[model samples]
Each structure stands twice: as structure tokens, then as C-alpha cells.
Target chain A: MAVVLEVEGLKKKYGSLEALKGISFKVEEGEIFGLIGPNGAGKTTTLRIIATLLTPSDGKVTFLGFDLKKHPEKFREKISYLPEEAGAYRNMKGIDYLNFMAKFYAKDEAEVREFVERAKRICGLGERLKDKVGTYSKGMTRKLLLARALMTKPALAILDEPTSGLDVINSLEVREMIKGFTREGVSVLLSSHNMLEVEFLSDRVALIDRGEILDSGTPQGLKEKYQASNLEIVFRSAVQ
Target chain B: MKNFSHLLIKEIKELVNKQLVISLVFMLFIFNFIGNVTKSEIKKAMAKQKIAVLDLDKSEISKNIIGALNMANFIIEEKSGEKEQVVKELRSSGLDLLVVIPAGFGQEVSNFRPGEVETYSYLKGISMTGSRKSEIVKALLQTTNEFLSNEYLKKKLPDLDPKLLKAPIKSREFVVVRDRMAEGSTSAVIGSLYAQSFILPVILMMIIMYSSQMVITAIAMEKQNKTLETLLTVPISRTAVVMAKMLAAGIVGLLSAAIYMYGFRNAFSFNTGDIAKAMSGVAPILKQLGLTITTQGYALFGISLFLTILVALSLATILGVLAEDYRTAQSLTVPLVFLVLVPYFVSLFADINTMSLPAKILVLAIPFSHPFFAVQNIMFGHLNMLWLGIVYNFLFVVVMLYWTTKIFSTDRVLTMKLKWGKRKVVL
Candidate 1:
């Protein structure tokens, strides 16, 4: 399969602290790649750099043959980034927020309507889509944001902690949607602390700690190589 | 450009929120209602100057002086009580003046010597009225002295005409304007002009201050809500983003200024009507002074005023980006508030034309000061200064907008944090 995104020698420094030191990874077409790490393990920083929201101190990120640094706007057109703790405009309705996000990709009213319909079906917000995002519950908001990310049908989706603060039911729903992305031939770069969820969703995983990638392989491959029963034990073994 | 319209629409919609709309309407109504009330009060006739006299010398001359005070539109209340009691009443009643005649006052005047008639003045505060009335009283005293001396001369030269002795050379004062004699005090006519020019700056300040604050708060809200990151990631250029924000904020500011001007104009235009009526007799003088501004001049002034407001909004936008939250944003606006108020107070009293070179340069250096002088410059046909001010303001705003756009393009906008001691405040 062709590689959809390539991140090589990505180095990010915040003041004197080096957040990402020479990190590299790649996501194949229609593959779910997870960066599994602890807090402050440079997971979000790497995603932010890939999203073109932060410029790397030293790195090269190529998305679909386009250099991200030199052509961030071009990269933005083919990718959707959902930051951790992202919020929609409070005064805007759920449908309105979807339509707003859709306009960035759709050219005409008919295309925008089609995107909105897809987002509605994915979110399953039904009747509550007309309510302002400010009035939505946390789970419902997360679901709507997930739908927003998928509605554009971008080539790559960068999600940072997609299910960080959701309950069990919402987490399941979000995981199901993320799994649905691969079926549509959409590549994903996700970061998470929940090893079990990462094990279930990620086709391949990278064990990262202290701004360095310790290892990268299939979830089952990492587990077998570390003589571990699961990906969590594999992560602990590799990082420790 | 496509995203610019979307962003601008979103910004304007946010600004015209229900709470802000209510506040705007409330400000409009209160300003106009109170303005009308104050307008009518100013139109009323001047109140009488209350005076108290402790006349210890019960002579004809002292009585004549007291009568003269009363005839000068002063309400003289005779207080025969002790000095302490008189002083207490003087302080309590807010009297304008108090005169104490010594017991031998009549004897001194009869001897043709300068009498020591003590006068006490009770002025409430700094006002033009108190000083103006004091000047009038001083002139009256000089005339009274002349009357006494003239009486002495009439007795010594009984055969001479009394009129010739009192006025050796009669002179008539005439104000010449463009070879035409004009009526009305020069001070009154100038005061009317100054009053007309004064209000424009105040209205401009209200618009700039209020609108700048809104822009700051809006940017701060985007940061607090974590929406700025998403916005920056959009496919739009940074310049387009900054332009959208500035244009939207400018639109809101103009709307607010329009509403405020509507209220203030109705209230102040009433007083202006009275001034126009009173100043009709001094038209030739006004024309000679080149104090009549054409509509084209007003249009130029309006442009300068708009540019001044844009500079303020641009500065506010920069401050907003540096702020961590809404509270920090408001604190950051202190510099802008000072910039506005300093010029506001100075323009109210200082005649910029007569200021020293250094003072004039200092005032003109502040971009806000130009708007304060807009009406004055236009009225006096100071087109050079007006055009210079407009250019200066335009350049200032352009520079600020460029800087603001550069800020928006940088990563510093997201990473810049205000450090408070050991803690870092990041939005």
C-alpha cells in the first residue's frame, strides 16, 4: 500500500525544552496509526506539527507528495485536525457548526448540503442538531466534532486524544466511527493513553517516550516481540 | 478572500450579541435624555450673584456703594451680626462676594484719599463665571474712583463743563471684520466656536474606546475558547484573517459612533441653534477669521476621524493577541484608555494653535490628538495641518495593521505568554 503521510526527523522545541526530538513515522493508505505514550510524551506536539499548526524546529513532513512546511495551505486542504479539548462556537447550532466546517471543503450549496447530511448521519444527533453547541452535553459535543472531522472526507485525519474525556458508551461510539474511517480508505494519525483502545483501533503502533520513538510495529507484533500478552504490557516493556 | 467574508460575518454576528445590543441602546437613551435636560438648563438666564454686605459705616457714600453693587445685578443681603456669624452665613449660602466697610470709611473718602474698603470673595470652584464677574467688579471700582475725583474737580472748576472734565477725549470701540463693524463680544463668539469643535473629539473617543474594547474582548474570547488554533489552521492567509477581524471591528465601531452621535447631536444641536442665533450678528467677524467650514472640509475631517479610530482598533488587536484571557485583555487596554483620555482632557481646554512649539509637536505626535483637532482645523481653514494629520493617521494605521498581520502569521501568537512571577499565563 502507498504511504499517505510521512514524518521524518521531526524536532520541535518549546523555548529550552525539546518536546519532539528527531521523531519519525508514516501512515499507509487506509491505515490507523497510533502514537501511544504518557502525558508530555510529545504526542500532541507531533500531531500539532503534522496538522501544520506548529512549525518544527527541524523536520520534513510530506502529505500526499506535498511538503507540509513549504505548502501548509495545500496540506490543510487534504487533512482535518481535531485537537484535544477542541471547542465549537458556543452560539452556533450543531448543524450550523457542521455547515461551517463543510464550507471549507465544499464548493457549492449542493455539495455543502451533502456534507451536512453525512455529518448528521454520522453524529446521529437527531433533533438536537438544531440546538446550540453550548447546550450540548460533553459526549454529544465530542460526537459532533468526530462527525465534523469525517464529513470532509479528507485523505488524512489527525486526532489528538479522540476519546480522552468520554464515558464508556461515547468512547465506544467514537472508536466505531474512527474504525469506519479506514473502511472509507482514509488514513489516521491518532494519539492516546488508553492502550486497550489503541490496541483495538490501531493497525500499527509506535511506542514514544521523552520525545523519542522507542519502537514501532503492528500491535500484535510489538506484543509478541516483547514477550507480552497485550499492547499495554508491550508499551511498558519497551519504554521501561 | 472567501474565508474573509465568512470570518467577518461571524465576528460581526458575535459583536451584535444581545447583551451588547442592550447596553448600546441603554447608553443611547441615557446620553440623549440627560443631554436634553442639561441643554435646557444651559439655555436659562444667568442666576443672580449672591452677595452679603457688613456695612459698619452708616454714611451716604457707603450706602451709595452698596446701591451700586445691587444695581450691578448682585443680590446684597445686609448682615449686621458679628463677623463670625456673617462668615458662617457667607460660607453656607454660597455667596459670591462680601464687602466690609470700616467705621471711618466715609471720612477717608471725604479727605480724597484711597479708601481701604475690604472685599472678601467666596468662589465655589474653578469656573469662568467667577473670574469674569470679578473682572467686571474691578472695572466698576475704577469707575467709582473716577466719579469721586470728578466730583472734586467739578467743585474746583465750576465754570468748566462737567462733561469736558469727565471725558477729555471720547473714544468708541468698534470691532472691524473685513471692513465691517460686527456686534457681540469677541470672547462670546470664540467661545461658541470652541464649543462646537469640542464635542466631536468626545464623540470620537467614545466610539474608539468602546470599539477597541470590543475587538480586544473578542480576540480574548477566541483564545479562551480554544477556537483560535482551529482558525489559524484554516486554508486562508494570515493577512486575510487580520483584515477580516479589523474590518468587522471597524464596522461595529462605526455603528456605535453613529448611534452615539445621533443621541448627542439631538441634545447638543439644540444649544448650537441658540449659538447660531446669537452669532448671526458676528457673521462678518467669523467670515474674516476664516472660521466657516465647507461640507468638503467636514468630509475630510470625517476621514481623518475614521483613520484615527482604525489605528486605535489595530492597537487594541495587537494587545488582544498578547493577552491570555478576557481579564488580561482588559488590563492590556489601559494604555489605549490613557492614550484616549490624555488627548480628550487636553483638547477640552488647550487651544492647540497657541500652544508652544514643543507642546504642539507632542500633542500632534499622538495619533489620537489629530481627531481632537479635526473640527477646529476644518473650521479655521488649517487645511495643511488637517491634510498632514490625515496622512499621519493613515500611515500610522497602515503600519499598525501590517504589524498586526505579521503577528497573526507567527507562531508567537499561540506561544506568547505573559509571565506573572513564576507562573506562565498561556491562552
Candidate 2:
């Protein structure tokens, strides 16, 4: 397998506080790479840097052989990012919202329509897709947003806390959708606090805490390395 | 640039969602309707005056004077009740004036004595009608004096022409500006010109203020909802995003300007008609001296006005993105609003041509003040000043756009927060 993204010596600072300190990671082609950490553990900061939403204070990031800093627009063209608390324009219907976003990625009306159709099918909102997003339930909105992120079929999907603030059922559904991405040979870099989710969806995982990556390996490998039964236990032992 | 239209459409849809278009239409409709109603009432007031005349002389001269008054605005009601009764009715019936023609008044006029006509005018404390009624009294006295003068002059020179005795000399009034006699009412011409000078700036200020708020609210909403992050991550350049937002705001601002101008034109249309006719006669002379506004002048004004709005939108978008939510964003707009208002108020009284050096410098220093001068310059045909204003506004927009685009292209756009007192919040 080829590496789709490489991050070396990625560092970020917010005034005196270092959000990400010299973290390095990579995602292989068609692999689900998860960064598992606690709140404020720099998982989001790292993912944002990868998404090209933020510039690292000091780092070198290469996505598909393109220098992220020098060619961010080129990098951005091949990736889709979903923030933790992503929201739609409340006034727009779910279908309209998808179409609006689709226009940014698709080449023509036909492609935009095709993307919308695929997103609608993924969301499975049916009649609810025509309703304004402001009227949709939280779960429905999250599903729609996830569907939007997936519809573009980007080379890499950067999801920061994809299932944050979701119900158990919604979280499970999101995890399933992320798993489906791997089957399609799409690369994913996901960050989460839920060890179970990271273990379930990620082919390989990095245990990060306080802006540093403590460990990185296959989920089973990390569990075995920590002499733990599950990833929760592995995460606890790795952070300690 | 590929996603610019998409982003622009999204902004326009949001503005529609906010009911901005509907609100403007409703405002225009209601304002014009009210204006028409007020104009009709003013016409009615100007058409006539109601008065009660108490004629104690009971002579031919008194009766003739009453007849002359009746030919004009006076609706004469003969005094039959007591003075208190008439006075009481005066307040209720809206009678404008009460005339008490004293006894022996005709005999005193025959004896060449100055006979007094005591007039009691009922004036509402805050009403504009008081001065109008005073003018009516002055006219009435002048007419009565003329009748008395004609009687005296006829007897003094029975063979002479009455018109010649009435007016020994004929004089025609002309307004002299820079040693040239100018036609048209100086009051009306100057009044309308100054009126435009005052109102255009205020209108531009309001449009910029309102449209900037709309832009800020839109940007702040995207920031709060985290949608802007998703937007920036798209393939489009950051410059496209900033430009699209500014364009959308300018569109809304222009629409608002159109609505406001319609309302303003309608509200003042009745007054401007008379002024326009007065101005039309002298317009050629005014234009010869480059004192009248031309089509190009309006075009230039429009350009500078639009540029000023762009500058405002740029500032608003930056501040809005720097704010975490609407409350913070609105609070951030206060200083900008104050800056705009300072120019608006100053332009009302301060003439830039005669302004003190410090005051002129202060006015020129605030970029918001330039639009006010743009109006005055075009109307007065100060092309040099107008050109200077356009350049300054263009540079202002360029610098601000550069700053806004730089902000948009950075991580700071996502992390920037305003710090107040001991607390700091991400915008």
C-alpha cells in the first residue's frame, strides 16, 4: 500500500500554549487512520492542519506528493473536512444545501445532480431532505452533513470528532459509514475521544495526549503491545 | 473563481431568508403612502384661512373691506355671539384668526387718523401654521393700506393715473452671484441643493451601515456554526471567498440604496416639483458656471458611494469573522457606526470650503467622511475634490480588501478572538 498523506514535525502554537507539538503521522491508501485522545489532546488541531484549514507553525505535510504549505489549494482539492460541530445553513433545505456544496466540487450540473443524489441516498432522509435544515433533528442533520462529506469522493477525508455529541445509534451509523469508506479505497484521517469507535473503524490508531503521540500501531497490535484486552485499556496504559 | 457564483448565490439566499427584500418593499410602500397623505394636507392648509370678523363700524368701507377679504382665503363668519362664545368656538372649530373692527373706524379713516384693526390669532404652541397665519395678516394689512392709499391718492390727484400714484417707481428683483443676475428663487435653488447635500450623505451612511450589518451577521453566523471552516477547506482560493462576500454585500447595499432613494424622491417629490421648475429656469446659468450636477457627476457619486460601501463591508466581514457570535459582532460594529455618524453630523453644518484647517484634516482623516464630500463635490462641480475622493475611496477599498483577504487566508481567521477586560472569546 502507498502512503496517501505524510506529516513530519507538525507543530502549532496559540500564543504561549502549544496545541500540537512535533506530532508526526501517516495514512496509507484506503486506510482508516484514527487519532485517539482526550479533549484538548491536539487531535483536532492535527486534523485541521491536514485539512489545510490551518497552517502549522512549523511542519512539513505532503499529500499525494504535493507540499501542503506550498500548494494548499491543490491539497484542498483532494480532501474534504468535517468539523466536530459542523452546521448547515438553517434556512436551506437539506437537498439544496447538498447541491450548494456539490457545486464547489462537481464539474457540471449533471455531476452536481449525481453527487446530490448519492448524498441523498446516503443520508436516507427521504421526504425530510426537502425540509429546511433548521427544522431537522440533530441526528438527521449529522447524517446529512456526513453524507455531504462523503458525496465528493475525495482522495482523503479528514473528520474531526465525526460522531461528537451524537446519540448512540447515530454514532454507530456514522462509524458504519466511515467503515464503508475504506471498502471504496478512500483514505480517511479521523480523530475521536471514543476508543471503541477508533478501534472499530480504524485499521491503525495513534494514541495522542497533550500535543504528543504516545503510540501508533494497528488497533490489535496496540492492544497486544499494552497487554490489554481492548483499545480503551490500551489507550489508558499508553497515555500513562 | 469557480465557486464564486455558488458562494454569492448562497449569500443572496441568506439575505432573502432574512426577509431583507420584503422589508424594503414594505418600507417604500408605507413611506410613499404617508408622504402623499402629508402633501395633500399641506395643500389644503395653503388653499384657505378661516376667520371670524366682528364689524362694529357697519359702514360701506368696512363692508367693502370684508368683501375684498372674502374674495381670497378668508371664510368670514359674522360675529353674532359674545366674544367668549366666539373665542371658545375658535379653539374647537380651528378658526385661524379673529378680526374686531372697532366702532367709528370709518370716521377715523375719513379724518385721516390711523384706525387700528385689532386681530387675535389662535396659534397652537408647536404647530407650523402660526407663521403662515402671520403672513396672511401681513398681506391683509398691505391690501387694506393700499385701498386706503388709493382713496387718499385719488382725492389728492384726481387727474393723475392711479397706478402711477400707487407705484412711483417699478423695480424688478434679480439675484446677483459673482456679479451676474441669476433667475429663479434663490431660496428654493439653494434650499434644494443643500437639501441634497445633507440627505445623500445620510442615505449613503444608512445603506453602508445597514448593509454592513447584514454582511457581519452573515459572516458571524457562518463562523459560529463552523460552516466557514468547511467553506475555506473547499478547492476555491480564499480570495474568491472574500470577494464573493463583498460582492454580495454590495448588491444588497445597492438594492437598499434604490429603495431609500425611491422613498426619498416620493417624500420630497411635491416640494421638488416647485423647486425643479424654479431651478429649471436658472439651471443653464448654474451649469455654465459648473455649479449644477451633471449626469457624469451622478455617475461619479454612485461609484464612490459603492466603493465606500465595499470598504465598510470589508471592515465588517473581518470584524465579524473575528467575532464568535452575533452579540460580539454587533458590539464590534458600534465604533464603526460612531465613525460614520460623526461624518454625517459634521457634514450637516461644516462647510469643507470654509472649514478650519484642523477640522478639514479631521474630516479627511476619517475615510467614512469622504462619501459626504463626494455628494457636495459633484453637486457643486468641484471635479478636483471629487476625483481626489474617488481615488482615496479606491485606495481605502484596496487596502482594506488586501487586509481582509489576508485574514481570510490564514489560520487566524479561525482562531482570532476579541479580548475584553479579563475575558477572551474566539470570534
Candidate 3:
């Protein structure tokens, strides 16, 4: 498979504290890749760098053969990112927000409207289309965000804590949606604290701890390598 | 380009959603109405002063004195009472001035003796009203004395021509410069005041309303929503992003300025007759000032004014990054307003030619200051200074743009975390 995202020697520091230290990884096209770690394990930092939101202290990221540093615009054109706990403009209606997101990609109004309808259907936002986003429940908002990310059918969609704050039903729905991406030959780079969700959706997982990737493989592969029954055991064994 | 257009559309839509459009329209209506009404009131007030005359000697000289006083715009009310009543009336608010003709006033004049007429007003303190009334009384007395001298000359030389005895060289003044022709006319005074009073308040309001909290909130909202990160990753150049934001801000500022000017124009009550002809004469003076402002000059002036507003909004965005919240951003706006107001205050109090060197330098160095000076210079026909002020304004805006871009480009400005106030990052 062709490599969709390539990171080498990625380093980041917040003042005196190092957030990411020389982390490197490659995400293959048409695969759901997961970066699972503890609360402060540089998962978001790595995602942020890959999204071209932050400059690395010392490293390089290449998206589909384009250097992110030198050609961020070109790299960004192929990627969509939903930050962890991202908030929506409360006053804007659901359909309007969807249309706003579509503008980043679609040139014509017809294309924008078509994409907005698709996003609405995918996110189950039909009845709540005209409702203000501020009135949405957490699960509804999460679905809306997921819909926004998927609107343009970007080559690489980066989702940070995609299921966070979601109920069991919405969580299942989001997981199934993420799993559906791989079937369409779309690449995904998702970060999460829920090992089960990561194991179920990610074709391969990178278990990160203390700003470093401690282990990386398919769920069964990591389980066998760590001499464990599941990814939870594997993560526990690797971090310990 | 598509992304830029998208961003611009988003900005305009947001402006509409936020009700800034409604508020701005309302402000324009109120400001215009007030501006026009104040001008009308000033004109009415100027036409309404009352004068009282105390005639001790009811002679031809006293009658002529009353006639001259009445000939003026004043409403003359004659009184036959003690000097004290006239003094009382002058002290009261009803009377603007009182003229007392002495008992020997007519006899002294016939005998070739110097005569004295007393004028009184209760108005005290060094105010424009007091000074104006004193000037009017003095002028009336001087004219009366001249008429008495001509009478005495007629009496002494019965065959002497009274017309020949009149001052050999009498002067009649015509307004040479079109802009200056309004001098001493209600329009001129009102025009200068109109230009001044509205410029500062409206500019300050525009800067604070559109630039301060609006820019801060927009940026902070992006940061909060995480949309900023997604936007940065897009193929659009960072410079383009900043330019788009500045452009958006510039549009808002221009809209606000247009609203203000509309309000002021609606409020202004100048006589339209001969105004165009008068304005034409000032065209050469305007040209010398680097203005070249005909009606077309006003159009160019509008363009420059829009540029200056763009620069101001850009500077506001640069300052806004330092603030963490809407309140902090708003608090910081006070100093910015004060800075803009300094030029207006100086222009108001200081003589244009005798301003302190530092004030002159500061005024010339600031974009906002130049407009105040430019309008005055254009009106007064100081073409060289006007041109200098325009150039200085242009340079100041350019330099500010460079600095704003520099501040935007710095990495620390984007990522530097600011807690409450231990020490702010210097970026």
C-alpha cells in the first residue's frame, strides 16, 4: 500500500516540557490507523503537527509526497482534522455549519448544497438541520463534527477523540462510521484513549506512552507479541 | 482564491448574524439626525439676541444710536427708567446687552467735547458669548462716535460736505478664497465644528466596535473551535490568511466610516447656493495641499480615509493578539482611543501654526492625525502642509502594515501560551 502520511524525528516542546520527542510513523493509504495512549502521551501533539497546525521543534512531515513544512496548503488540501473536544459556533444552524465546512472544498453553490445534504444524512441531522448547534447534545455534536470531517471525503481524515463524550449508541455509530472509511479506500489517523474502540476500528495501532510510540501492530499481532489475550493487556504490559 | 472567497463570505455572513449590520444602520440613522438638528439649532440661536437701550437724552444722536443698535440682528427694546433697571435687566438672562446714553451726550458733541456712552452686560467670565457681546457693543459705540464727529464737522463748516468729511478710504471686503468665504458665516463655523466633533467620536467608535472585541473574539473563537488549526493546514498561504482577515476588517471599518459620513452629511445644514462656486475657488488651494479635492477630491479623500481605517483595524488586530479574552481586549481599547484622540485635542486647542514641535511631529507621524490636519489645511488653503500630512499619513499606514505582518508571522505570536500576568511574551 502507498504511504499516505510520513513523519520522521518529530519533536515538540511546550516551554520546559517536551510533548513529543523524535516520534516517527507512517500511515498506509486505505487503512484506519490509531494512536492510542494515556492522558498526556503526546497523542494530540503528534496529530496537531500532522494537521499542519503546529510547527515541529525538529522534524518533518510529508503528506502524500508533499512536504508539510514547504507545501502546507497542498498537504492540507487532502486532509481533514477534527480536534479533541472541538466546539461549534453556537448560533449557527446545523445545516449552515455543514455548508460552511463544505466551502473549504466545493467551489460551486450546487456542490456545497449537495455535500451539505450528504453530510446531514450521514450524521443523522435531518430533523435538527435548522436547530442552533448550541442546543445539540454532546453525542449529536460529536456526530455533527464527524459529519463535517467526512463532508469533503478527504484523502486523510484525522480525528482526535472521535468518540469522547458520546453515549454507547452514538459511540457505536461513530465506530461503525470510522470503520466504513477503510472500505471506501479512505485513510484515517485517529487518536483515542479508549483501547477497545481503537482495537475494533484501527487496522493497526501505535500504543504511545510518555511522548514515544512504545508498541505498534494489529490487535492480534500486538497481543501475540506481548503474550497477552487482548490489546488492553498488551498496552498495560508495554507501558509497564 | 476559493478559500479566500469562502472566508470573506463567512465574515460577511457572521457580521450579519451577529447583528452588527442592524446596530450599524441604527447608529447611522441616529448620528445623521442629531448632526443635522444640531446645525439647525445653532443657526437659530445665532439669530436670536436681545439688546436694550437706556436713553438719558432723547436727541437725534441718541435716536441714531438706537437706530444703529436696532439695525443689527438684535431685538431692540427701549427703556425709560433709571440706569439701575437697565443694569438689572442686563444682569438677568433676558437681556444680552444694555446701552446707556449720558444726559450731556448731545450737548457735549455740539460743543466739540468728547462724550461717553456706557454699555453694560451681566455676562462674566472669559467665554465666547461674553467676548462676542463685548465686541458687538464696542463696534456700535465706535460707529456712533464716528457719526457724531461727522455731525460736528457739518456744524463747524456749514458749507462743508458731510460726505467729503466721511473717511476718505472706506473698505469693502470680498471673500477671495472659496473655502474661506464662509468665514464669519454660520456655515463656516458650523462646518469646522461639524468636521471636528463627529470625526473623533465616530472614529473612536469605529475603531473600538469593529476592531477591538470583534477581531479578538473572531480569533479567540477560531482558537476555541479548533477551526484555526484546520484552516492553517489548508493550501492557502498564511500571508493570504492574514490578508483576508485584514481585508475583512478593512471592509467593516469602511462600512462604519461610510455610515458616519452619511449621518454627518444628512445632519449638516449649509446653504447650497453658491457653495459649489465657493468650493471651486478652494480647489487650487486643495491641489496645493496635495488634495486636488473637488467633488472628485472628496472621492479620493474617501479612498484615503478608507485606507487609514484599514491600517487602524490592522493595528487593532495586532494588539488584539495580546489579549486573552473579550474583556481584556476591550480594556486595551481605551489606550488606543486615547492615542487617536490626542491629535484631535491638540488640533482643537493649539493654533495650527504655533503647535509644539513634538505635537507637530506626532500628528504628522500618525495616520489619524493627518485627516484632522488635512481637512483644516484644505479649508484654510495651507496646501504644502496638507500635502505633507497626506504623505505622512500614507507612510504611517504603510509602516504599520509592515509591523502588523511581522507580528503575525512570528511563531511565538501564534503558539505562545499566556496565563494571567506573570510576564507577557514580547513577540
Evaluated at residue B408, the lDDT of candidate 2 is 86
Candidate 2 lDDT, tens digit per residue, A1-240? Answer: 999999999999988999988999889999999999999999989988888888899989999999988999888888989999899888899999999999989999999999899888788899999899999988888899989998988889898888988999988888888898678888999999998888899999999999999999999898889899988999889877
Expressed between 0 and 1, the share of native interface contacts present in candidate 3 is 0.47
Question: How does model 1 score on DockQ?
Answer: 0.54
Clashes of each: 0, 3, 5
Q: List ranges where model 3 is wrong by over 4 Å.
A: A14-16, A89-91, A107-110, A131-141, A163-183, A194-201, A219-237, B16-18, B46-57, B79-139, B149-221, B224-226, B268-314, B332-413, B416-420
Task: Please provide, for model 3 over A108-217, each residue's C-alpha lDDT reduced to its tens digit, 9 standing for 90 to 100.
Answer: 88988877876877798788979999899888888888888887778999999999988899999988887876687779999999998898899899999989999798
Distance from true position, residue B406, model 2, in Å? Answer: 0.3
Ranking by lDDT: 1, 2, 3
| Model 2, position A212: C-alpha lDDT score | 93
**Model 3 over residues B1-427: C-alpha lDDT tens digits?**
8778777767655544546777777877887778766766566556746777789988887787788887866778888788886687567566667788978888887778988898887665544555566687798788778787777787888897776767667554333344443213344444434443445445544553455445555555555554565566555666666677667766665566667666665665433443555555444433443433357445545655655666666667666666655556666567667767766676666655677787677666666665555555655557678677666667777877777666655455466444547756543
Off by over 4 Å in 2: B47-49, B89-96, B107-114, B121-135, B142-189, B195-199, B268-275, B378-381, B419-427
Taking all chains together, the TM-score of candidate 3 against the true structure is: 0.76
DockQ metric for all predictions = 0.54, 0.83, 0.44
Model 1: clashing residue pairs? none
Q: Summarize candidate 1's per-residue lDDT along B101-135 as a digit string, tens digits.
A: 87878888888777867677778886655665676
Q: What is the TM-score of chain B alone in each candidate?
A: 0.70, 0.83, 0.66
RMSD of each: 5.5, 3.3, 5.9
Q: Which numbered prediction scores highest in TM-score against the true structure?
A: 2
